[model samples]
Target: MTGLVAAQGRPVGTMGRMASTAPLPLTVGFDLDMTLIDSRSGIAATYRALSAGTGVPIDDALVVTRIGPPLETELAHWFPAEEVPAAADRYRALYPSHAIAPSTALAGARESVAAVRALGGRAIVVTAKHEPSAELHLAHLGIEPDTVIGRLWAEAKGEALREHAAQVYVGDHVGDVRGARAAGAVSVAVTTGPCDAQELREAGADVVLADLTGFPAWLRAFEAARAA
Candidate 1:
């Protein structure tokens, strides 16, 4: 069991959900990459570009499959520890060119963010991508979140969620579940990414939905039940 401090002094039990009884605002946090956008093509292209420039052969297909983690982490798998930093820098330099056109918001992504706003809640994005890159994706997709915190993965995401006092965190990766749980927020997993429903369930997601399309109704019902 991974231990994490509760957000805003709220009690977070073993379930990793906030145990507070006070009426809290419906703040929601989201993961970018596979959760909101299909960035595989762009990511793969960038890796290929890096390989071409550095004369290092890279398996773009394998790289694309491991997108949820940080670019450095992925680079480390291929490059030596000493070479990772430079390789990562090269990758970031090549990313924007390859990313812009091919990257697109996944279905129901906008609606999910809109749902949070509609419920008088603030929507934020926490991602492993660089902050500027994450911002570019949001701008390109025309989806607005109250805040975007990038370059944070796993437990590091917990600190940001705590600062925002998020009640719900939605994502498509198991890392997202761990992050949400660490922050004591509801971990809502969507099976639109590489991970299937059962995989997400085993990862300890509180609620597993087919995709973000189901989130609005689920949130509504959850709020109604809480009120009742």
Candidate 2:
């Protein structure tokens, strides 16, 4: 039920190299999973469970690499399309209990969200994971985003940005770079996922961060530019 679905839309722009000018009021979009919460331990456990259940002998590194997209998209790469539904069902059934028990929020994530909110901006979470699962993870992290979109691909997330009127997107995957560009929003990439800063830059991200641990300074810079 999730992938990059093309809808008639405007393309978003990246906050890439902007002219020295005033910044505009903006809504910020964020990615869940690795960007906000460190799901590595849980995701690794999930892969282990999947391997044990299917006897497919999955590799944790390979599986973890697929964490940024929809479960069905990842499943399609390793299994038949017909098996995707059941695999997703099984994964969902197992994850809450067996897989994600060790999940935790990333450092400075909560502070970043609050900082954005304090600045009269809104933060919405856009994720490729299932919606409910995304929400649970957010709750687990003690965050209350203005909105949470799940199971979306780049183009789908672009559409979501249009719906939310978002002006910038902060994420940690190359696909997020594509989505922000496609949506005509400023794209900011974080190096919290499998993708590296160089990878995100190559994907045409507007901004690249080591992590959200230092977002307040960046946000302040953006605000200053906006007020200029």
Candidate 3:
């Protein structure tokens, strides 16, 4: 049996809004970084560029390790409280030129989104990164989700997910679990990012996947059950 269960522990009908009357289109939320885009190298390069331009000492390797949180959160570690705002702005400005080219789409990223559409569902990307920068990355990599929401993270990400009526939220962080929980959506976590499987489970993820490669199978099983 596939372990794709709903929030209340039901194996079938993962969506809280599913109706036995008729099958309706579904919306699935995904995290941008780590889950959809392997932006670690690009992000690191951007940080390095920011450091060079700002004359600040930033550890690109170290920053890339904890990649799920917001940019300002990490900037705080390297910049003074007063300088964080400016540094964040500068980083965002440098990101396009320094980060976009090197960033690559994670394996199965395109197929995962297409899988949603193949089932008459909408795939959306929710992220903490700035909206413009997020759009640039997606444009650069040719990864097109139906909707892309930016500047949201962790529990705060629930705002956009709820608005889109997303029944599932896929991501690579414990914060993402909280976001899905906040929106009453099933949390499907991928192990491609900093968080490990155990950590994701401990954080209350409903499903733990090795990477996006397994998403289509999971989505297939999920829809099959919903239509059952």
Off by over 4 Å in 2: 1-25
Candidates sorted on lDDT, descending? 3, 1, 2
Estimate, for each residue in 1-228, the C-alpha lDDT of model 3 and write its tens digit: 677886677766545445457655688999989999999999999998988898888999999999989999999999989999999888988888989999999998999999999999999999998989888999998888888899898889999999999989999999999999999998999999999999999999999999999999999999899788
Give me the runs in candidate 3 sitting further than 4 Å from their true place: 1-24
lDDT for model 1, on a 0 to 1 scale?
A: 0.88
Find the number of clashing residue pairs for candidate 1.
0
Residue-wise C-alpha lDDT for candidate 1, range 1-228, written one tens digit per residue: 465556655445733543355467788999999889989998888888999999998999998776788888898888999999999888888888888678989888999899888888899999999998889889988999999999999878989999999988898889899999999999999987778899889989999998788888998887777555
- The alpha-carbon deviation from the true structure for residue 2 of candidate 2, after best TM-score superposition, in angstroms, is 59
TM-score of each: 0.89, 0.84, 0.90
Tens-digit per-residue lDDT, 174-228, candidate 2: 9999999988988888998989999999999989989998887888778667666
Candidate 2 scores a C-alpha RMSD against the true structure in Å of: 11.2
Backbone clashes in model 2, listed as residue pairs: 11-183, 11-184, 12-182, 12-183, 12-184, 12-185, 13-184, 13-185, 23-225, 23-226
Predicted structure 3, TM vs. truth: 0.90
